[model samples]
Target: QSEDDVKTHKGEDQSEDHIGACRGENNFERIPVAVSCAEKPYKCSECSYSSKSSSYMKLHLLTHSDNRPYKCSECSYSCKSSGNLNKHMSTHSDEKPYKCSECNYTCKWPGVLKKHEVIHSFDKPYECYVCNYKCKTSSCLKTHIRIHTGERPFKCSECNFSCVTSGNLKIHLRSHTGEKPYKCSECNYSARTSGELTRHKVTHSLDRPYKCSECNYSCKLARDLNCHLRIHTGEKPYKCRECNYCCTQSGHLIRHMRMHTGEKPFKCVECNFSTSQSGDLKRHMKIHTGEKPYKCSECDYSCIKAGTLLRHMKTHWRKAKLI
Candidate 1:
């Protein structure tokens, strides 16, 4: 047919094809034909449903009723289509549905699998108009926009603790309830978050997968690699507001601030002694318990503090020096 004739037919059938059809966004193809001839090239025998592709009609047939032909022998799970049955089988087989080509990472859900695949690709499709902040996915760019706008939609009902990401909010909620859902199977040790549990599991293994580019330094966790990178970059992002002091770690800056404020949060209940640090409080508690944890291998000498044991060992070093 001519190009003009095709356009005329398409315009005439556009309204007819959309009468009982899925919206333009939902459907992949919009085959617009003349109204009288728009009964679809392919029609379903069971229903008024019609599609240009038989595959689309086949999908619709599955939703007609709960008549699942494909069944899983391991479980009560069944599906109308073989494709869905294959996806369901992955659950019982202990296999990930989608795996990344670049890494050993795998995920059960397709949406999560797609997100994982983006990390391997160099494409950054989404970008912020305000700051030119680029992200691999649109969802990530949307979250990044919140940082510039200061739009914290996710808020905790317990307090004024607000965050940009939903994952951060989820991890924050565990703090209030003291919930440790991720547990180590090798030991009784559990963690508040999966990332913490993953780090704990690395202690059991000697393997350090993440390595630094600038130095020979390697670490078990990606976060440790990031922290090591900062040492080479000399990027002390964490700074004490009270003083000119800056640190690679936020924890170090927090402790430095405490020295200035004299805010000793950790207090010894038995005595008037208080400390700005948890480690100092722990050592103080050992005084009440008479716990001599540190010991010298060369002598039978033991001490409450590790520093005290090290000082005691210096006497033996001096004796060797005299000889």
Candidate 2:
């Protein structure tokens, strides 16, 4: 055979060897012949992809089949390769074998550790096609794409609740489960959501971090500060659909909607008396409990409502005017 006809196992040129003689006095070892491209030794019945090696064809066949021979003994998790099954087995144990060299990051799976390494690089390969938005991970890019596509793929199986991202859907699922993962140590107040817990914890703190530049008003939440800033700006984003009424916040718009709908959610325990607002229901409770919280500063006059106290103060003012 010609030198060009035969090649090494590493696909190196056999140009150094002669046709039928050795380079020196010692006989040359016969290198493995190059596999013929015309006749592919291995062919996958599942797909059109054919290869010279039987191992490559077998691996390709696994992609088509749902048959996961390699499975975890602890769990129902099944994978095509033994490597994936070994990775899945780590979930059953507290073994985080793979560790990141750059940081203190460690994970059970190598793939997870690889993803963590991307954070240290500070290179965001994924970019949104719709805008100039870029993020570190592909998952973040997928979530950002929903902004343009309006695709809320993740949905709650329990209810009609759906969100643009999986994280939002996970938070929404807590409402159905009644799961309050976050708890306040200061007060025994448990909240279903993290934001609720965060806001609740702020009541314990003396300092109000979110301060309004326009006025002396301060709050715990940035969202509340944003809403407060609208008071100075007079920027009412929410408007009543039924009427010409407008509001700065969405909560006000929701309450205004109840006015048009005639849907009274808050009800008195003593009577069938119901009101759209919770504050109105609390005021209605004073009628049953006879709780006169509002008091006049001038006289021993007290009333259930603040409006009644203002009217009672006028009587003291009228006497002073006559004097």
Candidate 3:
């Protein structure tokens, strides 16, 4: 057949086999007539990748190999393809083409934009088996399940500390490293996590939205207000397994459990003095520094702790027959 006849066939059948036949007489002989006339004939054996173009198939094959020809100029990021390298370059820039219509959220990638869009939707497919808690993503549901299971998969190598999430574990590691990446804008206060910095920032603001009905107690967060309410109600929800001791806060329960387990996690760097509570360790350090922060108003006497100063004031009250 003439070249004009092949062009007519190309315009009629846009199949890969028809395109192969139009290439050369040898190409027409190589491709079998019985072969499937699929648009994406070039398939990768390594993965479920298939492409209509041979160049796209070759690029897909590079993903299966260790060869990274594309390198970023701004960073040490290297990718197997130019397309992926172009995506990596966005991290160096403030440009976000994909934006959410529902919110002020903007992302560099379309996949991330799609993920953010799910938050606007009322559909929460992922639900917890143990609780009524529901989330948009399966990963969120998996993290929420840890609360019921008491499973702490993320563990620290420096200490026996373990947390429900890897993000919490990462923040815990910063405590050992003394790395405070998040800083408060209002003060010189710094924290290991952004959440901690956010909470600290609230202290600078005079606006206390959460208030107690029982008393004049007020806080920045609803969780803090809930905790403060326990003081008026005398609700000790957190209980000890070994003893009848209970506390209103989970941290208090954790410290109380240490007494039964004989676990003194907080230790002094200057000496061999150790304690279960961090406040106890701080008070113990004062013995080394000879720092008496608590002072008596009635006398020239000063003490390391406020409790000691209070006891000392009681002696003057007894002298005046005030008791």
Clashing pairs in 2: none
Instruction: Looking at model 1, report the run of 10 residues with the lowest lDDT sum.
Output: 23-32
lDDT of 2 by residue, 1-323 (tens): 65655544345564544422321212222323455667664555555676665556556667777687996676455669887677556645556789999988677777778877887877888886645556798887876665445456777777544557776876776666665555677877877555687788888888888998888999888898988898898877555545677777646766777766676756666888988887998899988989999988887888998899998899889999999
**What's each prediction's clash count?**
0, 0, 0
Instruction: Show model 3 residue runs off by greater than 4 Å.
Output: 1-153, 213-216, 229-248
- For the record, the alpha-carbon RMSD of candidate 2 to the native fold, in angstroms, is 15.7
- Residue-wise C-alpha lDDT for candidate 3, range 109-138, written one tens digit per residue: 998798879878899998867545578999
Give lDDT: candidate 3, residue 145. 66
TM-scores, in order shown?
A: 0.48, 0.44, 0.54
What lDDT does candidate 1 reach at residue 259? Answer: 77
TM-score between model 1 and native: 0.48
For each candidate in the order shown, give its overall lDDT on alpha carbons.
Answer: 0.71, 0.69, 0.74
Better of 2 and 3 by lDDT: 3
Candidate with the greatest TM-score versus the true structure: 3
Ranking by TM-score: 3, 1, 2
TM-score attained by model 3: 0.54
